[model samples]
Target chain A: MQAILQLLVSGVLLGGVYALGALGLNLIFGVAKVVNFAHGEFLMLGMFAAYWLMTLTGINPYLGAPIIGAAFFLVGLAFYAGLMRFTIYKPELTQVFATLGLSILLQNAALVAWSADYRTIQIMPAGWESIQVLGAYVPTNRLVAFLYAVAILLAVLVFLRSTFIGRAIEAVSQDLVAARLMGIDPDRVFLMTFGLGIAITGVAGGVLMPSFYAFPSVGSFFVLVAFVVVVLGGLGSIAGTILGGLLLGLVETGIGYVAPDLKEATHFVLLILLLAVRPHGLLGVKGAEKETLK
Target chain B: MIEIRDLHAGYGDTEVLQGIDLDVRAGEVVAIVGANGVGKTTLLRTIAGLIAPSRGSITAEGEAIGGLGAHRVVERGIVMVPEGRRLFPRMTVRRNLEIGAYAARARPRLKQSLEEVYALFPILREREDQLGGTLSGGQQQMCAIGRGLMALPSVLMLDEVSLGLAPIAVKRVYEAVRAIRDRGLTLIIVEQNVGQALKVADRAYVIQGGRVVLSGTGRELTNNEDVRRAYLGLTEHA
Candidate 1:
């Protein structure tokens, strides 16, 4: 029982990071209606940014998360202004290929810049690493990441619910024409959404740096995890991402215990089955996948 | 005042508004009435800066606004309450009303606007906490019009205000529109309901095949034999 409880705790902690990662992707998809194929590359860049921040300045990645967030926000804006602006209104094929092309370019760029070294941050004091919670030992870093994830997610929800710009983003996501009629610029909303989405992903990357490795290609692994979480959660729903992540995490951890070698295959199988059975996801609104921004 | 001279606009490769000229003076309610495919919606859309007019001039108070984006046009005080009440379904009625006051120009008067909107549609105040999607069609149209009024626009354009509503609900909406116009706001009403539109408008235009086929005072056009034959489906005998 304790062994199972330990896996559940670990799964939930891991799910926190998964939720954070998927939230950004969902935001971009929800508002802009662009399935950002290069989302994982942004995570990779963020991890590198966190790694470099620590190596160069010795600032803890958690402390450097805000810095990474701000930088990534600018990177996101530039990405939209330079490339996404053209493909934003185009067909799904155009958007898919455009982002896929960007993924290749960025992956190779990171390979050229950072090489393939896997790095992790050492943040904990010598003897105080794990905490005992309900008879299950949990790592300090994982707990901190979980708290940060939940706090940031809550903050995002508050922002969406309270602010004018946030409501405008929601307005655009719900009905673009109606939003336009209200004098809200969809382009400006798209820019802000992209900036916010990428920024959140960057912060998540920074937060996860202590628990995970920072490598040029590590994003490919995470991107798939994010996709599973997003699909399971419901596309474009913020709260749904959390639910999806937790579910996937528990499932993956359980599978890891039962069939450790086939753990990775579970994601694809679950995703395929979920798509076949309930493509709208567990919490997603009905017919949402069919609703495009244009 | 707004003017459209030889405006040509269309979806890609298919023209919808071709060589259209219109002049709407301040404090005058102008009605554009036409059949379903006769470019009534297209004209209002182009005027509101949703669709860019090709090979023509759209001047608002003598400034060319043909190429300006919708948000900018809104800043200049031209707002549209679309045909279908396109409320943010998941959002609350209050938020939907608040978003209408989102433009910088209207932000300062947000409080006043909200009060005025609520005053015009008192039921909306009662249901401020309710989701916009849950409202009946009549109530949704009221919220939509109320939302447009929240923008504090000088030139308010309403597209098909009576599309899908009961007769009494339509009467209530028209009454609110009449009240709005009495306050000296310039209005452009586009509708397939010729009688209702003409009744509320000061001047009227009959559009066919993307061009203005006739124009006169609301009563003149309403009484015109050709307009009756074409729009009202009334023959010489009737």
Candidate 2:
């Protein structure tokens, strides 16, 4: 019974981190209607950014997440203005290829800039590394990341519900042509969505850096986890991302308890099963995936 | 007041509108009636700046707004409630209406405009919390119109509003049209239902092959032989 409880606690914490990482991808997809293939690469850069900020400025990553978020927001805007603008309205294939190219470019850039060495930050003091809760041990790093995830999820929900620009993003996602008729410039909405989405993803990466290793190919692993979380949760759904993340986390952890070697394989396996069975996801509207790129 | 002269527009290499000329006075309810694919909707789209005019000019309140995009044209008070009642399907009815005030000019008057829209369509107020896609066709039309009104546009263009609605729904929609006309706002409507459109319009143009084949008061077009035969399905002898 204690073993089961331990797995559950670890799963929930890991799920929160996954939710944070995928929220940015979902937000960008929801509004911009483009699957940003470079999403994982952006997260990779975020981890590197966090590492450098701490190395150079002596400010810890937990303290520097907002700064990283703000800087990545500009990178997102430049990404939209410089590259995404041209392919946004084009065929879905064009967007897919464009982002895929960006992903490869960013990965190779990371490889050259930092090498393939795995890096992890040590922030927890000697005795405070893990905490016991209900007889289950929880890593302090995972707990902190989970709190950040919860806070951000609430913030995103409020932003969508109460703000003008957030509602405009929602408006554009539903109908691009109609949004235009409502006097919304699709370009401006796209730019803001990308910025905000990347900002969140950057924060998530910075928050997760302590618990996970930072490497060039780290994005590949995270990208799969994030995509599965998004697909399981619901396309374009913020709250659904949380649910999906938790479910995937529990499933992967439960499976890992039985076979540790196959834990990494669950993301791919579950994504395929979910796609074949319910592509619309738990909260997504039907046919949303089919129409986004067209 | 708005005017379009020798306007030509179409989707990439396929010209749908060919040198169309139109005039709409303030507080006038003008109907542009024609068959499907006859460029009636295209004309409204061009005037609303959804499409650029390949040739000719559009002037609204004496300002030349020939090639300005829809976002810019909206600041000048031209708004469109596109066909199919293109409400943000996932957004609540209230949120959809609020989005109508997205234009810079409409933002300041959001509260008053919301009141006006609610007063115009009480059902929208009732369905305020519901997602737009869940509404019935007639209700969606009302929601779409309410959203357009939220923009506080001087000239409101409705394209194919009566397309998929039932007869009673169409009548209710026209009643709202009458009320809007009485409120002294310019209305440019493109409706497939020729009989219903002509009854509500002050003046109308019968478009054919992208040009205004006939223009007259509502009653005159309703009585004209060509318009009667072509649009109303009536012959001189039948």
Candidate 3:
């Protein structure tokens, strides 16, 4: 029973990172209706940025998050303006291919520049400590990261709900034609939304770098987890992603404790079962079929 | 005032509207009536700048607006309610109305426009927080009209406002249309119900095969013998 409790605690902490990772992907997909296959590459790039900044400038990875996030946001904006906008109005297959090409290009670029070495930034400025809660030991860094993720998520939610541009994003997501009728320039909204989505990954990458190693293909693993969370939570639902992240985190950790080898397999099996039983996802909108992909 | 001279437009290979000419003076309600697939909606959509006219000039107050996009046209004070009530389904009635004033040019007058829209359709005020998709057919129609008014447009175009409504709901929508006309805005309505269209319009045009077949004062076209027989279901044709 104590072992089970310990696993649950670790899972919850890990879920925080997953939720943050999925948030940006969900936001971009929800608003733009395009799957950013290169989203994981963005994460990989962000982690590397933080790692290099720390190595060269001796800056803390935590302190470097906003800088990397801002840089990623600009890159995301340029990407949308230069590429995604043109292909968005095209057929679904075209959009998919365009983004996939971008993903391949970015991944290979990172490989050429950084090589295949797994790199980590060791910046413990001393006095780092862990805490014990209900007989489960929690690492100080994971706790801080979890709290930071939660704070950031809440801030994003508030911004999306209260600000004018945020509401415009929501309006565009619902119906682009109707949004245009309301005098919203769909192109501008798309550009900014894409930027915002990428920006979120910058935050996630910075936060997770202290504990996780960075590699050219690192984003692939987390991006797959993000897709699973998105599907489990329901597409275009911010709240759903948060819940899905926590639930999956707990489930995976619990299963890992029972059979460590089956941890990854368990998630895929659950996903398949969920798809077969509830295709709309846990909190998805009704009649929200595959049409959203279009 | 609005004017379209020698307009040509199409979707891909087939030309939907060929050399169409029309005019709508300020404070006038003009009805463009036609059978299904005759390009009535297409004509309104073109005027609202949803589709680019292949060739021709659309002048609003003497400024050519043919090449402008729909949002740009709205910024110029021409707004469309669309054929169907294209309300954002998940949005609240209030948010849907708020989005109507997304044009920065319309920002200063947003409060007055909101009040005017709520006054014109009190039902919307009552259900302001309800999701637009949950509204009844009549209520949704009202919301659609209200949304257009929220733009504070000088010229409002409604496409098929009377479609898919009960007789009583249709009457309510028309009454609102009449009130809109009383406000002295330039109105262009595309309607299938000839009786209602004729009753509300100051001038009327009947379109056939993407061309204007007949046009006159509302009463003149309503009283035309051929129009009565073909469209009004008079006994001579039956």
Better of 1 and 2 by DockQ: 2
The DockQ of each candidate is 0.88, 0.88, 0.76
Best by DockQ: 2
Off by over 4 Å in 2: none
Candidate 3 chain B, poorest ten consecutive residues by summed lDDT? B229-238
Models ranked on TM-score = 2, 1, 3
lDDT of 3 by residue, A1-294 (tens): 788778888999988878888888888888888888888888888889888888889887688788888898998899899999888877778888988898889889999999999999765556665778998988777777788779878988888777778888998888877777788878888999989989888878887888899999998898888888878888788888888888889989988888899999866887788788776568777555375522
Cα lDDT tens digits for candidate 1, B1-238: 8988999998888899989999999999999998999999988888888899877999999999987989999999999999898999988999999999999999999999999999889999999999999998999999999999889999999999999999999999999999999999999999999999999999999999999999999999989998888788888787
The candidate, 1 or 2, that scores higher on lDDT is 2
CAPRI grade, predicted model 2: high
For candidate 2, write residues B51-107 as lDDT tens digits: 999999999989999889988999899999999999998889999999999998999
Which digits, one per residue and each the tens of the lDDT, describe model 2 over residues A1-294?
A: 999999999999999999999999999998888898999999998898888898888788899989999999999999999999998878888999999999999999899989999998888889999999998999999999999999999998999778888888888888888998999888999999999999998899999998889999899889999999999999988888999999998999999999999998998899999899999788877876776632
- Evaluated against the true structure, the overall lDDT of model 1 is 0.90
* Residue A254 in model 3: lDDT: 85
Q: Write down the RMSD of candidate 3 (Cα, Å).
A: 1.8
TM-score of B chain for each model? 0.98, 0.97, 0.97
Model 2, residue B156: C-alpha shift (Å):
0.6
